[model samples]
Target: MRKVLLILVLCTAMLSAQEKPGESRFLLRGYAHSGVEVRGDETTFVGGSFNPIFLWRQSDKLLFEAELEVEYENGETLIGLEYANMSYIINDYATLRLGKFLLPFGTFAAKLHPAWINRLSSKPLGFGHDGVGPARDLGVELRGGIPLGEAKMTYSVYMINGPALNDGTNPNVEPEEAGMLLYDLGEDNNNNKAIGGRVSFLPLSNSSMEIGFSGLYGKVGNVESKYEDVAALLYAVDFSYVSKVSFLSGVVDIKAQLNGVQVDDASYFNVEDSSNYSFSNKSSAYYVQMSYRPVNMSTDFLNSLEFVGRYSELSFPEGALWTSDQTQYAFGLNYWVDWRTVVKLSYQFADTGAHESEGEEGEASNDAIFLHWAFGF
Candidate 1:
């Protein structure tokens, strides 16, 4: 804990001493989300997520950002850090960032920005805060944008050297671990490291498309005899289109993994066949969503009273993977309260596959409707 505080202090001191002309601003912002969640079996959980953020910009190229979040469930409170980072711009084409920041991975991971709250679902199916990966990591990142005539290209590259696992599952009692890959290797030094990028192109004034791919490979150092480290691969693609009648958008995501028990001289699984098993798991899902804003600049309601709908499906084969199929549909009406706030009402349904022992057809999923208030600055 002391080390974490020390690092934050050092980053803050560095940014305070460097400031460009007319490039200083301090801002505070936040929002809260409360709603009832119903599962496929009709179980309901009433909960809410409240996040508060603070940002300081010393210059157009140097800035500090942070967020603190608390999730409330009944009378219990779960508190944690969401973001704390200091960024330095090298030039118009590059920026160097240090401290804890969001890992630039899947589209949903980075796009889950706080201010853009109401524009999305109460929960994004399998992304951040959903058990896959931690929201932020301690590391350094490089990100920037390039110009191409009337259109532009954007990119991000990052390397994190903190907790290898996001679930507080690390076995190390020390602050940070570093060493070699073989002689000094062993299981003592397990850390998280990754690299990824994104590219977008605009062929028209109101329409644009993007494709992204990211890979994460690391090990959770200490594990029980029956569990080995994990190697994972993830792929994603996304697109969005805008027009007078409606807007169309979609995303496809896939994940595959390989993992097992570690081996030693006295280890169980050997070259010969054995009862122990190694597993290969794969899961993928996709969604097509569209919304129609009947009111436009030339119409009444001024873009209010819009209607939106979405459909998504996910499936995993029945082998080593926890096989299941899920389908979700949502409909909503949104009214713009002001330039930076909006009110929304929505309904959603989800269905999951059944086990062979159940022996009956799966039942229709439960439905939920919610009213949401959102704002950002």
Candidate 2:
């Protein structure tokens, strides 16, 4: 808490120092959301969050940015740091960044995660908090963009403290988290650092479409431990396309991404007994979404209405004790109050796939409806 206060004071001092021409620039912006959810014979006012982003531009070549998330849950207030990073432009084509930053493994983490920006009330399956893919990390990054004649290309490369795998051997670790990757920041359990990056291309001359590929590789075990040799490899492909169709009299937007994770074969301690076990240690997740809005229509209310649909899936390694194959279908209707504010109503259905002995038909869970209002400031 003291560190956060210090940082805020420094930002304020910097902003106050800009009394002359060619001075620095400071900006405060972020998003917040509040909502209610309804399920089988139950209705509850969902929790909410206030996320504020701070930015300080010291010069044309140097800048700092950070984000904070504050939420109230379980009768307690929780504060979290999303990221805090300083960036320096090295040249026209490259820049250097250091400190905690969101992983660019996919566009979602680094780009489209703000509550006001997401069309649906909830994120896709196996995504967002405690998702299957990597999120933010303390690291050094090199990023830039290039022009390919009429097309464009961009890239990012980074390295950070690698994630640690839970093997159910530690008393403090939960048995349900065994065989899963954990991103506990502050210190490294080993000397190895994770390496990752993302590269994307916009082949369309108008820049209406983009395709991206990203991956990360690292050793995920403690040094000198029996699981030291265990490593992980992950990859993802993502795409976005948006166009204005005259025939439909509306704008069509489509986005999709698929992520795959593979960990080296390893034996893990069975917390239930004095034994060990191993599995494929492979998992994957994906989501496809589309939305339409009659922006060019007649009245303000008519043009502000948007319809969205999404399908997502999560496939966890089945042999693990805490594993399941899950799928989600979501549909939403949004009212755009403005460019940065929206009221959304949505419904989602979750299906849990059966195990080998549970038969073919998976068990379906109760579907629910959500009403949320998101604002970006």
Candidate 3:
């Protein structure tokens, strides 16, 4: 990985030098965020952070993106190439993007590549892998738009295949086998494919609405788990209303999964003998959010604030299902630092159900206050 990254940087530098003076149409963009917080239990003194991002876009034909992060929990270093793709412009109607990129999933997941697309809080809860997998993947996709009488429509379709296991932890072990086995007897079946799509419509010149749906079905059978299958489905609807004086946006996100004869995680998988757990078990999570901004985009500086809030719920039969339901409330304030950046602060409250096991620490009502600085170009 290190050698590959070095080569990428060198290639980007060469591309930059070859361009004529001020004639190069190449683009570069990046973002960084860090937060320090004292949770409801202030004694924890938790601090979380992520390193800066780097990207090189050569006239939209070729692009390279990467990120390096140091986790605060255990202080582990993680680095990966998020995107290194080549794009072909097929006239003005559409563009063909081939290589490692984002899948056409949920609204938030699709827009995660651009830091300024939405508030940072809208992330995390929706995607897996701590919002990383929720972003991009090793895949190929097509994206573009079409014009209508008074409005326009946009769309995306993709076919993706890559490692589903997370970087920091082993995704093979069942949650029930916490510290029992260090390795799996079965072969790693990360070789799988997925398909997804999304579309948006604008009935008026300045206002728009979108509905998206995505599904994945794959077989990851190796020697040990000969018939293990992993699959998932997602759906979402987004509405945005923008006028001269105010802005309102709302979203409904839903997701479900079925893992047959496969070990997903302790909470979602069961591998015990004669358990007969091979049947397709269904699970889901969803959230509804609305945000209203009183200030118009024409404002010079950070001239206004928006009141935003959301409610989310999740359930899993394999996990502590009775105790898995939760509700969260968040309030945010946005300040424009410049044309490409904004500073945001928000607070969240979460309530969980009671744990079924006696050893578990049941449910707890907790609060988290966060401050995030987001920017893009």
Candidate 4:
């Protein structure tokens, strides 16, 4: 508690410090939220996050930025440095960034993840912190945007310390199991670095539509015998559209994303013999969401409300080592108090695909309701 308070004090002091006349030296901003959730037969109180962001303009061409998050969950507190990086603007179409930063693999993870920005309360399936998609890494990156006639194109490329493979005896670990195929942070078990990037295109003028594609490839696993070389690859494509229509009398927003991953030489062919292994790796996931907000409405309350719907799924091939596949459906309503504050209510239904036990087919399912208040400043 003291440490968290001290960090906040330091941030406040930095933001409040006096600066030279006509010189913009620093700025601060962030988003936070808290909520209560009722799931199945249990109800829990949640302390969302106290995320603070700092930015410094050292010179005309140099800038520094960092974000820190303090969160509480399940009677425990956790702190993390979401991103800390420096950027040097080379020109109109190129900027260099070095240090730990968010991965440029997907639009949602890189751009629309802040509590104040995301329309939905929860992340899509297989795209959360430790899900199938890569989140952040430590290294250097190049990114920028370019204007082409009436359209725009943006790109980001990075090379970072890749994920490490789990060579443990147990194959059912939370994240690193054969079925989960999770990646370790801050360390690379092997010497190879992962390389990936995203490219986005805005094809229409005065339109909020973007199309993007991303890919990442690298090798994971220790150099020791029996666990030598496993190659990992990920690919994703996403699109988003926002527009106002006459019939709906509102602004409509739609987003969709699909991603897949493959890990070569993932499992051993012979459980009794470690030397016998095969390369049969496959996994995929996708999500889609739509929302509408009335514009130019007469009443204040009606103008603030928005309706949302979403569906997502994650799957693995049949006969795979792990026996789990998941699908989710969600509906939500958001009321914007201001540009930087919101109240949200949502319900989610989830199903884990059939599992056979004792020659009988059975499925697992869950239902949950959530209420949250979020703000940004």
Candidate 3: tens digits of C-alpha lDDT, residues 269-306:
33343232222233445555555554434554424555
For model 4, the superposed segments whose C-alpha errors exceed 4 Å read: 1-24, 169-176, 269-279, 317-320, 354-362
Ranking by lDDT: 2, 4, 1, 3
Model 2 lDDT per residue over 1-377, tens place: 99999999999988877644574889999999989989978898866899999999999999999999999787788999999999999998899999998888878777877889899999998776657778788889999999999999999999989678877777787865678887736577789999999999999999899999999999997788888989999888999999998999999999888888888888877767767888889888899999999977779999999999999999888778767788899999999999999999999998887664656667678598999999999
Per-candidate TM-score against the hidden true structure: 0.69, 0.92, 0.68, 0.87
Candidate 1 runs further than 4 Å off: 1-23, 35-47, 112-120, 131-135, 161-189, 203-207, 218-230, 243-275, 297-302, 354-364
Question: What is the per-residue lDDT of model 1 for residues 1-377, given as tens digits with 9 covering 90 to 100?
Answer: 99999999998977876653456898888776654444445645456677788889987878999888788776889887777899998998898988877766545545644634435444434332322333456677888777767666667777664223212123352211111011112123343453434454555543344444444444433344222354334445555554553342222122221111111211122123333323234445556656665543554475555566767665443322234556677777777676667677778877776534446454567577766666665
Instruction: Name the lDDT value of residue 34 in candidate 4.
Output: 91
* Candidate 2 steric clashes: 0
Candidate 2 deviant stretches above 4 angstroms = 1-19, 356-360
Candidates 2 and 3 compared by lDDT, better number: 2
Please report, as a residue range, the 10-residue window in candidate 1 with the lowest summed lDDT.
Answer: 175-184
Please write out the lDDT profile of model 4 over residues 7-57, one tens digit for every residue. Answer: 999988777774434444798989899998999888887899989999998
The residue pairs found clashing in candidate 2 are: none
Highest TM-score against the true fold, candidate = 2
